[model samples]
Target: MNPMIRSTRLALAALLLTALAGCGDKTSPQTASSRAPSLSTVVVKPETAHREQVWDGVVEAVNEVTLTAQTNARVLELPYDVGDTVAKGDVLVRFTDIEQKSVRRAAQAQIASAQANFRNAEAQYKRIAEVFSKGLVARSDLDQARMQRDAAQAALHAARAQYSEAGQQVDYTVIRAPYAGIITHRYVHVGEAVQAGPPSPQPLIGLESLKDLRVTVQVPQSAVDAIRNHHHAEIMLGDGKRLAASKVIVFPYADPKTHTFNVRLLLDGSHASLYPGMTVKVAFAVGAAQRLLVPVAALWHQGEMTGVYVVQGDSVRLMQVRVGERFGSRVEVVSGLAPNQHVATDPAAAARYLSSERAEPKA
Candidate 1:
């Protein structure tokens, strides 16, 4: 092993290491340049807007009445069924009144008999008084005659009162509608007996006016204050039509179980298609506060997270957001967003732009 020969071998080894390092650097640059550039995207300018709160509700008739029987009797006939339209004073039901009629007739006969007895007693009393005045009868006899006449008059008056009471009982057999409306329910059927007074099962006949419809909504305790203060809201139908409502009446009491207040809205006009118990979506404008809003196309929803893409300096950045009320084709951004920011309308193109930016090397 000569010294000069060993030194030459070391030099060659160092030269080989330098050549390998140069080759590695050259391969890295080529690999980076081979990646594609990111694509461009369209941007949308989001605006600051106010959002409304929507609540679910049900439609009902403003005027509703329940009919009940006043006396206990077998139902003889029911002229109308459920869903039947009835006018005021229309006969809705009829009970068997034959026995009542017979009682009335008996009362009338008693009145007549009493009246005849009163006439006879009156004539006898007058004749006796005349005799007494002419000295033909004593004072005691005249007094007895007068007493008989007074008793007959009292009997006649009692009989008359009995007849009137019997007549009223007979009238109760026929049930009539109190107002013009459609019959929503019929609790009694033919031959069904109904009892009067409390604790007795009473018949229920439901009536409602379809001309005026109303909606009742339950507002959460959190939103009750808003409803009480503003009293302005909007109703959205299934078909996407919105009705503006400025009148909202809040029930003073809140439900103990739900802790929500009941609110009723009077519809402006009669909605023919609307029926009682129909579910609807209601939106109430509690306060006018500005927030950020964007179109639905600009939003991207993933599992448990919602976000949008904003174009910034030739690249797109993903932004998480909290959504609020929806106004037609637009939605309110409750948080994680700012006004006047340019968001990418197309999410796919925006993603491509982001990926390309990451792939590019520093200038």
Candidate 2:
């Protein structure tokens, strides 16, 4: 009749039962919440499929140049400044032309002197020839006249060449836009000296055509083949607007440092927002085939894993999916998915709608 011993034995038995129950339902809090739907569901279906790869792109001018002085001269007149739009052959900047002008003038004077001397020599040569034919003058005198005439002709040719070269030097003083474009930057100010050569010492201005635009991407080695082999591409603007690429160019060589190939996507026409140096996205269709698709909003991420919530009959299953290219609002499922499955649009909200118990079957 040990009453205290009997009470202690009952408490130990209850404790053991509780421990066993807890061990059987070993689920983490995060896992438990993820298994249930917090919101509504979406049904996914097979779509006319295309695989897309998005790459970071930067907008660039189709025709861009850094304007620099062609000769060593002081900047005299800079008619255009930063942001000024200019037409082809429109004078952009002017350097000092005093020396060039002087050279031109001197050459012109020399040409005039040569012409006058040539006129006198021609008249003397004609007179001397007549005298020689008549035997009234020595043969030596006629030869002397002929030599002077030839010398005058040579001098005239030299003077003309010098003048032509001087004229070119004068033209170099005035800088003009080669094509219609906007001046993005002005590197040289008034009175600044600039040198011109193969390696320009300083850039005078930055000119870029706003009307014609393109985007450049350093595509990784993986995507280069698909893009180079006649795949479709589109430029995605920051506001979510998509424009089909008019031209696609893949650089023949990959950069040694980055090991990525350069790709240029030429846009169709002038866009107000698309300009040089602006960041954008480019989508390339790497492959094409029929595949299941669901709205991008349906996808959820947990660390490195991406998944979606799916409804299977009376029960909901949180699934892991392998995804490919983004097609507007929807994304393609490469694996871990089957056609005609119900997918939740928002996994977080959908989780709140489901419980540990299976959903009831509908009529």
Top-lDDT candidate index: 2
Q: Give stretches of model 2 more than 4 Å off.
A: 1-49, 135-140, 195-202, 291-363
Over 236-343, each residue of candidate 1 has an lDDT whose tens digit, in order, gives 766544666547899999999989999999888636667787898888877777656677778776544577776554334566678876666666778877666676
How far in Å is the alpha carbon of 87 misplaced in model 1?
2.5
- Model 2 TM-score (2 dp): 0.63
- What C-alpha lDDT does candidate 2 achieve relative to the native structure? 0.78
Q: What is the C-alpha RMSD of each candidate to the true structure, in Å?
A: 17.7, 13.3
lDDT (10s digit) by residue, model 2, range 182-276? 99999988998788765645688889988899888999998889887755788876655568888888899999999999988878864787878
Steric overlap count per candidate: 0, 13
What's each prediction's TM-score?
0.57, 0.63
Which ten contiguous residues of candidate 1 have the minimum total lDDT?
Answer: 23-32
